[model samples]
Target: MRMRITRRGGLVGLAAVAALLVGASPASAAPGDASAYAAKIQVTLLGQPAVTAGPFAEAKADGPTANSLATVHLPGILDTGVLNASASRDDQTGAVQSKASTADVRLTVLGALGAEGAGTRQGVGNNTVGAQLIEAECHATQQGVAGSTKLVGVDLGSLGSVDATPAANTTIQVSALGVDVARIVFNEQIHNADGSLTVNAVHVTLLGGVLGSIGSGDVILSSATCGPAGLPIPMASGAGLWLGLGLLGIAAAPAAVVINRRRRPASALAAEAD
Candidate 1:
């Protein structure tokens, strides 16, 4: 006898297997800065795909520590969203201080065929999804220290589905001591299934004048599906099904063989009695 599986049943089974393989962790707050007069930021996801939506934000600062200036959450089948932070600190002599800001902060999710599959094929629908930080600024001033850094035309990170070509671009600029240190830009041309794509840019400016010095920088971080909260396993057709079951120690062949052997033994015993 042959066994048949429905699409919905198969998906549920696959999801269960994925949960067992990847496990699940409760969401927690983002960590604080390691040093005084420093700024820190983080993103977290709440639940698994097709179940919960998230990518929450928790930001903090010290020594003129900044507050969560603004935050946006775009939860979906998978957790996704962004956070921003801004703060300023100054010294008694006014010779030392720091000001910083982060924007377009977000998390992303993408789907791809499992390694066991033959040709490469992305998941259907919106396989690429993420948030962005339109801009960020960090400025520091110190006396007697003269240094500069710059980043321009560099790829910070990418968002959107693998099935569609990205149609967005991102760029960054950093400067110090009256000189351009870096000018970086990242351009993407992937097509989006929903025909929606956006660009993000971060600009940093640092100045060290006469006996004073300054520093500034920006960054774009990303993960496979969820954010720092943890890696949430994603589901797709073809290889995804087998991969999930295999990881859970329930390979199709062994299970099928066990069932067949059990049925054969019962039938053989009945025939011998007759």
Candidate 2:
């Protein structure tokens, strides 16, 4: 019963698997979806002029939905004050939700190295037999003046569960006087196969990193997408409407009381046979 689409990011099945990730895709959408965005910078090389910037302050929603977005800037690379993504569904009772969030985060690349954040969030929720996942970790910080190092999220969900369905990629390697020079990512969940869900919190894989030319890339921040928990009520499609209303109250409630006493009249059956 709530719908919004201005802070759009995880647009349907994670932009159809992010246009196939470096190349991704998987969006046909169903189960009332949700979306949000705060940043997306895609640069390319090989030929050049392919420096697409932004997916900023984006939002999307459908059916029982939700979405939110606040500020964003892409001067050096990225900046955020608040960005939230959401996906929703009520489906008569089988609730659902999907979300992504960001706040006071900043980034700066090429001008040095890049990474910073005061916040970041990811989500996934479901009902009608169980499904749950929502995180507010990811308070990363790497502006240590000599490069960054301060992470918290990514403990494999307390070292036990794992249900991001088919998507969960997190990596960050940006070193300097020590060596390693690129690769940064932070993904949340994605259980799409129709049961929609796509969260790409942040991803940057510019093909121009280290070599291969100079520009040809990727960047996405605070993305969110929702579910596909198949809903139709009646205990989710079964019991045949409570066994056809208990055989229509045990065989039609006495054939309507003997057809209302044969429709009366015949002088009320000859005045009850006087």
Candidate 3:
């Protein structure tokens, strides 16, 4: 006589099959775990409040003076995760010849990474593993019209990779954003039972400018599949989101000025007419 499997047993078998499919899929199917982490970078140019230099007259030159500020926040979820990050800034001319000039063209950057959390290895229980790392870096620089380059950067390498059991070897989502900068990167490595290794690399880079004006940029992302090669799924979602937000800011700048002008009293607005 034929035997019938119980409904509960059928469901259990389906779950097992699904898990096997996910684990057996190529590396291309999973991107590094970036969705769990978020980063924001902001730069403000204080600009020269008052130009002390007289027209056609040069003031005494002082050494290049720079003021830079940076901050990073790592959530508990990503604590102990590895992070290797850096940032930089520069003027179109690329050189800050003097303190006053440096003030005229200042740069800043900020970044952070999520630390890996505690968990068991996939398919293997009872073993504890270390958290993964979140890496980041930032910097700024100045260049003279003659092509001299002066650059400064800050590196945050505390987050990059972590030790975790197989339970932590699942797929990870990622997102990244930046402005007027060169590159953003996130990567991961996979080790199989056979001892072979696979490395996944994802990065965003900025290129192109015209006559002192920054140009449009191109972004590319990998699909959520690694195939046989362990390539990180480069998701442009982060950069795209940032790009869209930046555009909105630019579009609103003029509106903000108009609104501020309108809010002023009529007498204040007409004061210059006297």
Candidate 4:
């Protein structure tokens, strides 16, 4: 005799298939064990030079600033994770000089799973990392305009390599009569299941000079990454279901904006100097 499958049975089978396709297995699909697992986090920064100064000289600058904090509670791999990355530049012109600074902070629970029990393990900590670039220019109508650019960035994963040549391109310009300035800063932190946390911070700066007009100077770049090692933990199936749903909410969140303001006029600079 032939057997018939019910609609409910078919729906259950289809759900199982969909979960497997996304790397979720019966063990992994269920909540994870936080006590025995650890996570890997990375961050990067990049900057570009494209500023000009003269009869209508102009300067532009931009850079990345990212911060994240998370609590883990399961035994699973959180590898190949990049928490934050950004790049920006500032462009201006005339006899005017300008300075501005802004900061952003975001707190998120990447994922959490596992049940409460005598065998459950718990911990708390933080990790931080960063990168930066600075460039400036000077000009002199008498002596032809001249300029120089430099890049100094730190890697969160390896503090020893902080002073090395940055993986990104950096440029600076200067004139005999003019002056330019630039600065970059980055910071980060992470918490793992082993009850431990690590923090990393990096800052970069650039300076140059020449004839003086400082006709115009442009460009800056930087990047960084960090990772920590620790044990794994257990997670309950119910927890896994909710964590998965939470990820969907994060994916649908709105994106942040990057501002690029117009250069100030020479008259504005003179008034500020006064």
Q: Which candidate is the best by lDDT?
A: 2
Q: lDDT by residue for model 4 over 3-87, one digit each (tens)?
A: 1223333444455444433433333121111110112222111232222211111112121222222322212211112222221
What does candidate 2 score on TM? 0.34
**Model 3 segments beyond 4 Å from truth?**
1-236
Ranking, lDDT, top scorer first: 2, 1, 3, 4
Give TM per candidate.
0.21, 0.34, 0.15, 0.18
lDDT comparing candidate 1 with the true structure? 0.28
CA lDDT of every candidate:
0.28, 0.43, 0.25, 0.23
lDDT, residue 25, model 2: 16
Write model 2 residue lDDT over 91-130, tens digit each, in one string: 5533345455565554444323322221223431110011
Give the distance in Å from residue 160's predicted Cα in candidate 1 to where it truly belongs: 12
Q: Give Cα distance to truth, residue 213, candidate 4, Å.
A: 4.8
Cα shift from native, residue 5, model 3 (Å): 72
Candidate 3: lDDT of 14? 53
- Give the per-residue lDDT of model 1 (tens digit) for 1-274: 2343333344555665765444432122222121111112121212222222221222223432433434434332122223333333332222221222233332222111110111121321233222322332222232221111122222222221221112233433323233443332332222223321112222212222321122122222220010111112233334554556554454444455546656887679689669
Kindly give the number of clashing pairs for every candidate.
Answer: 31, 24, 59, 91
